[model samples]
Target chain A: MAKQILSPLPGTFYRRPAPDQPVYKNEGDSVAVGDVIGLVEVMKSFNEVKSTEAGKIVKFHAENEDAVMAGQPLADLE
Target chain B: MPIKRLLIANRGEIAVRIIRAARELGIHTIQAHSTADVDSLAVKLADEAIAIGPPQAAKSYLNIPAIIDAAKKTQADAVHPGYGFLAENAEFADACAVAGLVFVGPSANAIRMMGDKVAAREAAMRAGVPTVPGSDGRVDDLETARRVIAETGFPIMIKAAAGGGGRGIRIAANPEEFDRLVPQAKAEALAAFGDGGLYLEKVIERARHIEVQILGDGHRAIHCFERECSLQRRRQKVWEEAPSISLPEAVRRKLCASAVALAEAVHYSGAGTLEYLYDDASGDFYFIEMNTRIQVEHPVTEFITGVDLVREMLKIAGGEKLRLKQSDIFMRGHAIEVRINAEDPAQNFMPAPGTVTELRVPGGNGVRFDTLLYQGYTIPPFYDSLLGKLIVWDEDRPAAIARLIRALHELQIGGVKTTRSLHLALAADPAVASAQFHTRWLEGWLESNATKLAAE
Candidate 1:
């Protein structure tokens, strides 16, 4: 079965903390459960969103500054 | 006087609307959004944007502290709550005042007075507006309810004295039904509005829901005419039209006059709508309630009167006088608006949120589409599924209908299903065409014709 991804909450997604910061993870990056992959910012507070399943990053489906709904898939892991 | 900078405290099309109006008046705009609305069209269009909170509206749009903080950070002179969420919330208004930021809506006192249905009804009666005859006030127990019913007769409606949405309403055809439905209505009312206060009203069957749009400045008020919002599904308006076709000239005059009178009596300020229920058979109208903010169907009135209601609200907050006298307001043509929601009408109006692969809005003379969407834009499912509003105006009702039909047909939105097809079918229905509709008419028609609608 494909690894399921979940949104931390409703918020905008940023691949990195700052404009010049490198992305924490990219496509094909191996990730373990509880590993931080991206940041979700709400009300000026940046939250470190962690992976719930250990897998390889299959796709970066959400763009930076993109609004994401709760439970929406932001990335695919396999 | 032009506003320097204005902060929009809500999301969706309303935020876009405020930005456009503010930009048109040469004002810098600040857009505030939840984490889930960072990429919303309004954010892209505004001069600046600040994140408020997470996707849930309670923590974001409805979070007064967060919104105030954003306003102060942006150095915004005013904040506009574009209907729903905290639009009519008195506490938010107070918070804005405390933060020294102008709230581009009614005063907190006006909202507090009108927010309670029972208080509003009483105020309307005192202002000489006709109201439904029922219990004098909230019934405390079964004994009081029985007594009130005995005085008012059967077929009464038990309504949440603090409720606005159709949520906390129960209709009892007789005493037996009343005994069972009253408790249920009270419980639902408490859950929905956080107030168990209940009032009774004589259920007016087959009533046409009409409302008058009013603009006030605390000292004087003017009415912008009326709109017939009788086309509803599950007590929510689906289609709205200005200058109701069924209302006689005398009734229309009385309705508008009464609305102005009520607003003046309250010393109301800013934009508000006075809702009424018209019994066509008896040629009588009764005050229902007052919404102390810009309404969702405001576009219909704007199309006919050419008024920028949001701009007026901002000016009113800045202590501007009534710009135009009552004589300046006159209906030019018939206008109709249909809410294009991101919901499947065939699936009991379930929300259908997804990325838009393609979007083509119909544009022509007398047609306007207010939306915050673009190609490849994903609709977040965290909020209301109302993607946009399709409005059209023409010389008459028939022309408006024709324009609406053409616009709906020409409009193309891919990636997710919408209520466009349902509106198209509703427009073609003969009963809707003839304007023989009530609040329950659309739901009843849809129930019996769901299969037919789906097949089409």
Candidate 2:
């Protein structure tokens, strides 16, 4: 079963740290606990979305700039 | 031509403000909203609402084409780009004109000129207004910079010509830091903005944030006193008042006149504000920039002067001249406005967007709350956190503070931590009551008081 990474805040999710930056993780990318998978931007402030369970990356549920809610699944890891 | 149908190209409290003024003037309203704001208070109040884009402001509120198209489709005669979003965009104003819709603000040329920091600085200089003592223009080399620094003195700001909005800024408290940071600033500026140009300006350490309200009819202008917004957090004004207690009667007159001169020089139209940094110690006021729209804190000025600023903006856009003279304006009493944002003041003001489980609005002879909140409304997380403004007026400054304290007790919002507690704490603070503070005072005050914000 694939474990899900949850967004800690309700905001717009981004795959990269910045507009010109690369995505923090890609499909099949290795993940570890405390590794930042993406960012959740709410009210103009950005909060990092970190992986809690170490596993191989499966897929991202939300695209960049997509509005997200707290506890929403952002990524899946096997 | 008088605006028959108006399209509001913004959201939140400001959009609701414009709509109320338009309705009173018997104008039809069309609200341009994003998908996320379909349930907003503005949409509910407007005659008709149209979706412009998705939730993100970049594609909706800031989307010029979508806003212009919405206006055209709704057959609106004018578009009011409330305070933020494309309010200061020169191209947006021009686009409104190109579509034959009246832009309810200044001319595009005025917006462009004031939008440029260097151009606005030069304009202020030409109008005989005081500006922060700084280098004349962008410094390309260190030799000229060093020479300029000798005249401006210590504690100067090293700003990138290509950088703005608090980016690419370095503070040099002394010559040593200046020497160390100038080269780093250049390299960073080149890497960030593709230009290594820099400028220098003296840092007024104990300055108060003062701004004058002005109304123009494209040919002449008049001042409407001033507002003191020294209490700010992260450059966002949290509390504001009219008729600054610190300014002497003579200094107030001169500061207001300079603002009028600058506005008339540019043939400004509609409502605008000229921001200044005032040093009470030296009794010097310097023009910083201009906001070419009706501001959020205009209500405090309105509470004191009895001049409806937003209504004046609508009238000016309808081709009306300045109805009141400078002599007609009078400061009646003290008024104050506090911004209520959806953030947990106890939790370092972390954004707290959630449903309003309960709402209790305060009311009285001199109390008013301009808000976009209602019970069960979920605050969308796509934009700023400003939820409303609580305004109060009284016979005197002390009385006004008393009224603020009274009204804040009556106001309530459940299910979300707000800045209400912080405001309550500030109202009871001795330093704030005495008005013994500078622009940087609140940040330092928050350091020791934040832990007690919610406990109050």
Candidate 3:
């Protein structure tokens, strides 16, 4: 079974903490219940996105720096 | 650079407005829209349309790189950022410069200078324009603020230097409140603006909100008189009228001249508005801030001055000097604009985002509706709730009010709730009709009369 990690806010989603940094988690990488998977930038403020369910990363549903709405899927976890 | 094909970097009524103005200038328009506005009226009316990103504004409207790419991709030589969103964003203007695109507005330095409230006040003061007395710069300590307060007196407003859209303001009426509010205001400013810059201003009691419209080509600017926007709800202007019926002729001239002086001092170009707080008792006005882009209430100014502000901005961007001198400008008649929002006034102004099942817009010789709505159009939930603006122009204030009332009654929108009924009631209200309302009067009136108004 796979579960999706939903974005908590409507903003631009970032895959890494900074543009120069590496990806926070690659596909097939293991994740914990409270892992920081991404960040959502709104009004020039960045908020860390934490995974609620522990599982291996399946795929990212949204592109890095893509505008996402609240409750939209960011990544799928298996 | 000649602005042959202009890209409108915005959405909603303003985008629709830009497209119309661009068409009048014989310039093709490419409307950069979000995925949510694929079927918007602006998209339908534009010469071409491009989807920059998804529904979220941060990715589409506020995304600097995406907007620049769209301008480049469409071969647009210029970009016009309408009010709100990134209209006042200095970095966005700088990015357009970096991309060799003519930004249909002022320089990035001017935007940065006037965008900050503290800096704007300082500039205004240097230009011999009176601003509300307060701290000269960001206040970091309570003792320093207290000393300033001792001179300026109490009932001061602690405002975020970079704040707009009516956010980041705290009022302290006494010493205890001042002590408690300064830190909270600083923290909120830091969170919102990414800077903890705070400044104070004396609260002018029973003040009327007046703004002067100006046009410049970075060399000389001319004022198009003033508009009174005192009728507001929750700090958002609900209705606006031009050549403020409240102002004496001498005071009006001084206010407009002061605005032009400040703009000249800053070498401001394009269309901009200088907002002021008028103390009716003292018969004096204090400069508040300057909006570096075309304002939402600009139509009321247009109705009086007969100046197509958007067209002038485009011409200025294309390297044309301002043709309309101060003597060339003339005020014709009184004009009133009522903002129709997609919110139920009875239900606490609740958001009513849905499809417009039916529509009947009012029109005549003097009534005009600036909206992005049409029959069968879906009102997206992602943006501001403004549905349209009902602008009525007549020979005088009373006649304009009568026209607005008739237009409001004739206008209808089905499927979603709107502020139409509220506007109708406001138009009929004796205080509003007589031009006796202040900036805070609408909220108080809504609290007391919204239910009755809704029932009617």
Query: Of the candidates shown, which would achieve the greatest lDDT relative to the real structure?
Result: 2
DockQ of each: 0.04, 0.89, 0.12
- Cα error of candidate 1 at position B69, Å: 0.8
Model 2, position B419: C-alpha lDDT score: 91
Model 1 CA deviation exceeding 4 Å by range: A1-78
In model 1, the Cα lDDT at residue B176 comes to 85
Per-residue lDDT over A1-78 for candidate 1, one digit per residue giving the tens place of the 0 to 100 score:
587677766666778867667988989999999988888764334668899999999988787767766688988999
In model 1, residue pairs whose N, Cα or C atoms come closer than 3 Å (at least 3 residues apart or on different chains), thus clashing, are A11-B35, A11-B36, A12-B35, A43-B52
User: How do these models rank on TM-score, best leading?
Assistant: 2, 3, 1
lDDT of 1 by residue, B135-217 (tens): 77778888878887787787898999888856578889988888888878887777768898999998888999999999999
**TM-score of each candidate's B chain against the true B chain:** 0.97, 0.95, 0.99
Against the true structure, whose DockQ is highest?
2
Q: What is the lDDT ranking, best to worst?
A: 2, 3, 1
The positional error of residue B10 in candidate 1, measured at the CA in angstroms, is 0.5
Candidate 1 CAPRI classification by DockQ:
incorrect
TM of each candidate vs. truth: 0.86, 0.96, 0.87
lDDT of 3: 0.90
lDDT of 2 by residue, B1-456 (tens): 888999999999999999999999999999999999999999999999999999999999999999999998999999999997889888999999999999999999998787666677789999999998998877777798889888988888998765543468789988788889999999888887677878888888989999999999999899999999999887789999998999999999999999999999999999999999999999999987788888989999999999999899999999988899999999999999999999888788999999999999999989999999999999998899999999999999999999999999999999888899999999999999999999889999999886678632
Residue B449, candidate 2: alpha-carbon lDDT: 80
Q: How much is the TM-score of the A chain of model 2?
A: 0.96
Query: What's the CA error at residue B77 for candidate 1, in Å?
Result: 1.4
